[model samples]
Target: MPGPVSLAEQVKEVWTSDEGSMAKDTASNRWPKIVQGMVDDVAETAATAVDRPQQEEALSIQAALKEIKDDMLQNRVLRPLPSDGRDDIDGYNERLEQLGGKCTWLACPWLFGECYLYRRVQTIFALTHHWRDYDIFKRQKDSTFAKSCKAVEELSARYMQVIANSTLPGDATNEEARKLLFVEMTEVALWGNATDLSLLSNLSLDQIQSLQGREAIAKSQRNIVDNDTDAVWQYLSSPLRFNRRIDIVLDNAGFEFFTDVIYAAYLLESGLASVIVFHVKDFPWFVSDVIAADVESLFQHLESASIFPNRSFIDQVVPRLRAHFDSGAMSIKQHSFWTTAYSFHQMKALAPGLFKSLQVSSMVIFKGDLNYRKLTKDGLWPHTTPFKDAIGSMGAESGIKVLALRTNKSDTCVGVESQERVDALNEEAPHGVWIRNGKYAVVSFSDGEKTDGK
Candidate 1:
């Protein structure tokens, strides 16, 4: 796990005037102050949220939004300062305004108002409301992750049904079984949305898969217990297999880590991998994106399970994971792949070798929402765009099985079919509410389309 630099540290860096072709403004002098003021407002608001609770928190969040709107209007943030034509500061500014408006909508308790990032960004803009603002963030806040969550639930139920029949076609030692297992595994990989929120709730994979029977939930829990993940277990239990390594493209660190650990434990128990590597960003990324420090935070939470309201459940799962970590079934390593400077395209240029290195691994899981956004390039493609097409060249070329399980957050999306479905969703849903609500999702997969004739 990586640690994020303090807000003060980030302020020092972004606030320093820099002049270059890529600089947002042609002149550096004025930009730094404007950027710093916004940063200061955010920092202050974070402090207020932390210090205050209950009713007071709402005011703090609103105050932060006001600061962003004010800065945008006063600083001419809507206008591009100066950059190569390739970089759209103006478009980005407009997007930010839209994003800010969406945040304001997220403040509504009736929606995903509890989401920290949405609330924080909303705070920044609610105080500044741009005249042309179309409540972009509001549209997003109402939609986003909601779709994926529903999709995963549906898929989980389907998987559970298949598993229950015992006629799942892949259970036998027959050749046909092997093939079916491969498809099942691939499906599992597909659902690896690296950022889906379903796992965070009680919606575990087994539960999703066993969505039948009067005791479906209990059955899922049982499956979690009875499943002999020794092979995957061995890898996760003692991941450094003398020569093997595993890589985890991380997501959010807190409770999300718990779900990830459960999966890691399964991989280790099943003998699917060895050596766990975690990739993280070098800076404060996408608001609550995981940095390395989250590892410790996760450990503390697991260690003191008694403190959690769901202590009994925690007690059952935490020990298995701890045993794996303690026994060296797992090891954690980090890389700064999630920074603003390294677009997926840029990653191709700068770290082709690193990705190539990862290609050798038995499995690599990219976690969480930001990675999904980056993978898809945050475009305005039609909802039905194929997942592979949206990810462009990088996703297609990698000789790895890339599975993306993401609840929608940004504008770019894929996996839906029909303009009618999209229009119906838009008409029935509120504003740009689809993206923010997490109602849509994509269990996208790409096999790295190896054309080398291996």
Candidate 2:
């Protein structure tokens, strides 16, 4: 007989019936809509196919995607992934097998269920000959990026000023200036995640603009109940941080990615880091998660004459980005571990190499809600739990300097001061709104200390 579920396993389970739960809403409402949209995108591809073979493959993929949506709606048992030559397939299937008969879309852990849906969607395209490399989420990603041009232009002007003025290789002369710039750029990057495509799907151009810009950013400062601005800045700006290498496990593409790039540029320019390594998803993921192609595509958009009217800003910024790539100051890395269903706490055992590589970095910045969820294990941690304690192995014991920047959009939250503040916020809003509204944020940081649990 299967062993009784451990306390750890019990916390991992995020059932769809939990009242006022994002997991429940996602499994029931959000997922079907997402999968059906993929079916529509695939149908469009099928109709536009140049040949019969391509059309046939597209139709098959569409059917498979539709089936996924139906399964979610029907709450069918979660199945092991079909063998697809991918290295991570076994790990996913094994996870399902371990669950025995209790696994289903609305009944399994929220984190695993969400990952399975995306991977299953990717599998449909993987099995096809003609559409194997096709990105079903490409249209939506590009469209959203295009829609965020105003914010893009606004940020461009702000970022270019810093790039044009700052010194590189050494900038210790103006300590206060560097510190202020770091705070501004980092905050810009933190809140950029408010527009994650997986949540807030129906945001208009005006709403997008409202979430960005200097005025909007300044206004959102009060919403950051848990602040680590000083802690992160003090560490990054410290004289001890020579030869710094910053790794940003990225979130959304387009506008958010642009903000991240700007933040990276500030680090490189102010001599904060010698190099920046961006971590991207190996496959298309979570609607807008950074894939390899999106990075290049963003630069193309940056250089576009019609999309952005500020040629002077574009001329200054675009080539600088290219230079970073050319000079090896900035690079992109992709590992399949990022797209897996497992929490980052399991990284030590599951993806030892990736975990080891990250240990050498100055700091690893996890952007957006999903990465934050993975870091914190997406569990029912009390709102008052310390951020360091919430991340388990990814915390102080692992000796990884970790910074998680996310606008809240789910149930798992920690690192706030007290239960009183949480109670006050809840009283002012609808139930569960304070935690998942995407209006509030947390900038939590931890050091690489094993001795005292820094």
Candidate 3:
């Protein structure tokens, strides 16, 4: 029998950056900070434990988290993941082994290394009896969500109005109005990605306001580096789109997810999609990535009187949102494939079930920077590469219509129409800011329009 293909041969190089990009900074800095957060959370929780065993469990996890941080600080070799009985473990271990088991925290591929850090953290808790179901990042996710009261309240009011207006005669019946609303709601979901806790560990309320405030929405629309919302709107508005299902590969848990839920409601209200399905991680991941439980937490926050201080808005919105899930018009599915380190190109092969499942949806929207990175195999393509080409087989003609609503927060950028524009942005702005900073975004869509590789 033949052996597995090498990682080098997988996609040229799973490129790791030491400078000029987010990965460099992430490896050297952000990662240690993330682990430190875990250590601190576990330590604090351990102090107030209910029993000696539980306290001991928390203490052990905290010590393990400290070791992971130390490994990064020391640039120690990447270790194969210990068995946790999860199916994705083999894939991660195989990749680590393929690197000769010698790749270090800072020296290895950035995407893989970053993902491994999260997976490593999960195993520490996964193997423990008391800490098995714990999410160390929950406090941060909840804290950030609380800070987003401004955007949350605004969106609740907007959602209530949209739901009300949607029922009126001739409201949004015109093509222009529908498309206009599409841009508005899509940008809401897009900019909400800016408050990502994994990247901005110390995100402030002012910073969160700057990213998600209603007043800034129109001005920030210009920062979408590659605007493909028109294409997504075109496809979703097509005659064939009637009664079709839409899927969102969800991103963050707090305010970003609130916008996603709002967007899902917009889809059903506008008659663009009959059903909305959310794909969430099975376990805690990447700091703020939505696990299945966060969906309920989001709704609880929405319904919280203290959080909003405006019962009228959430009262108008929350019940209808809950009704969709109850009525099967909207659903959430957790697949282990999402939590895996494998790039999306490997999906069809490594995660055949997920690939087939996604193929049936009218459109599969991959959310946030990490999903975008996995879709593009972590910045492997040139700036001028077409969105379809950059995503490999998941592109057009794969029977999966992909609408990537990503705020560029890393170096791996593709689908920008002009190299000259990229050059001008780089020259005019601070170094790598256009790509690494969450200020810019891309609304990339792919269908059978381009026939290069697919």
Candidate 4:
């Protein structure tokens, strides 16, 4: 018989009912066919896998999903306090935080998207089941990292010129060169959003051809936050020039962490920055940030066959990715920068050493949606507040050049300073949902020295 379900498993058992149906609705609306196909593929993969604890669990999950799909098809009504009620909302978020504490390994990327948590939760509220919010955090922790492709290699080449020009030459003390380096570092920070494969499929991440055309660039721009796109682009190619080290407030793990390491390696390889600091969570974080196991997994991704199935693509990328780590062009320093909860206001309090260390880097790039959320206090501001003030004394206290390239996921959004900008967004996208969607983004730049309230 199957062992009794653990708390984590119990939380994830939502797919057994209709109460946990939010994921089903969202999946149907945004990516019905894609979700269905992925589920079907998982079922096929499960049937072929050798027996193991994880594989068995995967099979069980596959079985559970069929019921969830049937619930969706039948238009089952769940009891979970009506999906829109505050009780359901609070219950869902509370469960996420609870599950958030259980797994610190950063393995739960699929909670909000893939994995079975959301789907299960939707089923949990079936009229036959008591109305209760299903736990959505379980699958979130499971689908955190997966395979990669040639996107890393293509990205390495795409930014090569930018990287080379952004660094300083030996014995070249020209002020212009320093300024240019600063600009370059700043822009490097901006382009951080150019490609993120965490949520994409293994095939998508692996295909080199996927990086072609203006689609990647367009995707990055659409993910801009606060509507300060020019500023974001300018920051991308801009140099920090300040006499300081570089700090990357990191997010995700597995391939995403590997990509971040690659970016750090590029900074050092190009001579753009002296020392690089990586700030990671002290505990399990918003899923897929970084954990002890992540370092090993990351190296495997770097060394393993890349996202491309072709051996030639792998041959070309292996050396470059290896060279970055082998040459000591990058070093990672893990710190508890993410535990400050929703506000980076406590950033100074949590890691004063990091604040002091930023003095050495020309710039600091806080990567991903969670860090951005903390920076802007989850977009709960008055909406007219300046980005600088939103960040407040956090950056000002240390005189670090703060550049964040983040898609709008959580609430805290800034840098859109004009009604015209808002109007433009409405014209481009009539839906007010643009603010919350990750499709539109902002590249917010704030100089610690400038009091102009960015």
Candidate 5:
């Protein structure tokens, strides 16, 4: 059998080749537009600067953005991140140098280059005065959330119904029922990834709604190709369940984030976890990855009568979320490692503090495709490779339980039961198209208990 194909090798396949996959679209279309949008935003914000120095800084930032866009279009070699006094910049530059000192936008590793693109964009704002804390993607994230009102209402109503009927801690009568609810909530969180902005850049409100709600989930259950939710439930319900803290490495901002919060709320309310810590990126990332401000934005939007039309549902749900924050049952945390290009396999070495923090959690749930890719080192491993093996150092014996709830949207996947299953999928869809469509998913878990090196 052939050894696993690295992401760089997979880039030569039609799915990742310059033909039509996300790599092509991202480098050729999405990034240039994103940079142009940032340029426009800087111009608009600069007009409102309070003083001359701030205005001058904004203009300089705008010029820097334009130059970055040009370099991307010209396929120039990737450059080192300017010294921003942030600890991670050195790590990023070192990685770039390791990859090859002359890697270009299109020619470089897809995962690393994509990460580098965002980090380079951050340098422009980091060096600026008034815009240092601004999020270039905030407007897009907010607008996407605004447009997802229908889906939001449906999920809020459904989540509330589940909560109303759920059995609390120590309620043994409906243990089976509670288990079913856990599956449903996990599925809800899994499918919510359909709305990620990186892949569905032109997604419409109707398109988003079609992918959400109870009906959508019911119809899509069969599409979950590799399900370990039962194992996850067992892990959570066993002796290891008590006084548990669950860490969520979050994904996109809009509807997906809403569902993720609902899942966290369910875990807390069911006493499956004592605390839920949400890990968000420190800056704008992959277009819509959640950051600290998004949490605030979500609550503020829920509070505003003008934004979301479902006032009754908001009234019921928003307070529960706010109470989680108020009573310290929930928390939002950020780490520079999340935004860095280093894969989760490198977590122990690259970010030991974050690694140690996750070790204390009952299970750390990594959400969405990018997180999945990072977990597996974005390698084209045989589809039947065990989930634990794919995750490397973060797998068994690492003392950090992990559950990856992801809709397959990239070329890399593992943990399926057999190569025959993967062959059947390829036969059905041809050319690995089934993996990138976002119609299928994987609910994979690692128990973190094995001590053997094998």
Candidate 6:
């Protein structure tokens, strides 16, 4: 067999080439807009700064934002991060130094550079006195959620019905029904990934609605080229159901997050999980990845009849969701490790606290393409590499159970049964177009049981 494909090799592919693909678009288009958005926010907020020192701080942030934008457009080398007391900053700076102190915008490893961009943007706020709590992406995140009202209403109604019909745990008579609902809910979460802001930047209201709901999911079932929902259900329904905590490392907010919450609600209500922990990013990341604030924002939106335009649906769902939050059946958490350059494979060595936290959970679900990429080290694995092998250290028996629900939006993937399936997919759409489009998906699971003592 050939040696593992390195990030150096992967970067030369069309996916990361400066010509096209989301990576190119992100570097060329999204990064400038992101910096400009922050500049605008700084300007807007400066008007309200009460003191001269605060006004000066806001001005400094604006200056930094301009520099950030210029650096991206010019493809300038990534600069070292100033000390921010966060543990991850040193790690980022270390990586920057290791990359010859000159990793350019369009040429660096896509995953690392993308993460670095967010971290660099965040450093501006960290250094500020008056703007530490400001979220530059808040307007976009809120607007996107507001636009997703239709899909939110539809999923809310469906979720309520599923909860109503779900059987209590250990009900042998309803086993098949519960399993079926598991598949449905997992698919709902999977397809929710189709609308990430970083990639599908121009999705209209109709386009978003078309990607959601039961009918859309039914129509797109054939697109799930690699599914392990049965394995997921089997794990959840296992006999060793004592310490049942389900941890979700979240992805994009708005509709996707809305779906994930309902899925967690179902798991709690149906007794599949005793508690649910949502792991969110500590800062604005990948434009739309959830932060802890988004959970409350989602609930606030759901509770507003004016925003959702479905009083009955909101009434049915909001209270139960609130109950979960109130009773601590559901909780949201964040850690610096989530936004760091290190992948999940390095979690144990780099972020042991987080790894230890996950080790105790019954199941940990990694959502969307980025997490899947990080889980697999963002390397181009042979198409037939087992999901467990692709994940490296995280797949060891001593590690935590992991389930990846991802829509294929990147080149890296594993755990398909055969290479022939990949060939057929390529024949359908040559030159790897089939994988980059969000139409295809994978529901991959790893038992996290060590076969050999590594």
Q: 283, model 6: CA deviation in Å?
A: 2.0
> Candidate 2, which segments miss by more than 4 Å at Cα?
1-13, 164-174, 194-219, 451-454
Task: List the candidates' TM-scores in order.
Answer: 0.52, 0.90, 0.90, 0.56, 0.88, 0.87
Give residue 260's error in model 2 in angstroms. Answer: 0.8
Q: Model 5, 1-454: lDDT tens per residue?
A: 9899744344222222355566666677777898898899778877877899988888788888899899988988888889887898888889788877988877776788888888888888887767789988887777888887767777777777777655445456456556666777788888885543221112122332343432443554667778888788877876543588899999998788988998899988876788999999999999889999899899887777777766877789999999998898999999989998888988999799999999988889999999998998887677887888888878978998899999888877888888888888889888777788888899989888795422
Q: Where is model 4 more than 4 Å wrong at Cα?
A: 1-147, 157-243, 306-329, 340-342, 359-361
**Per-residue lDDT for 314-421 in model 3, tens only?**
787889889989999999998888888888988999889989988888888889999999998885566777888778778867878888888878887888778898
Candidate numbers sorted by lDDT from highest down: 2, 5, 3, 6, 4, 1
Model 6 alpha-carbon miss at residue 65, Å: 1.2
Give the alpha carbon lDDT tens digit for every residue of 225-245 in model 6.
777777788777776537599
Q: In model 5, what lDDT does residue 35 have?
A: 86
If both were scored by lDDT, which would come out higher, candidate 4 or candidate 6?
Answer: 6
Give per-model CA RMSD: 14.3, 5.6, 5.8, 12.7, 5.9, 5.9
Q: Is candidate 2 or candidate 6 better by TM-score?
A: 2
Better-scoring candidate (TM-score), 3 or 6? 3
lDDT tens per residue, model 4, 62-158: 5555555654445443212234322234443444465553321123222322322332333333321222222222233233333235455554444
How many angstroms is residue 454 displaced in model 5 relative to the true structure, after the best TM-score fit?
Answer: 13
Which 10 successive residues of model 6 have the least lDDT summed?
197-206
Considering summed lDDT, which 10 consecutive residues are worst modelled in model 1? Answer: 105-114
Question: For residues 55-172, what per-residue lDDT tens digits would candidate 2 score against the true structure?
Answer: 8777777778878888888999988888788988888888888878568888887888899889988888788898888888889988888888767766766677665445534434
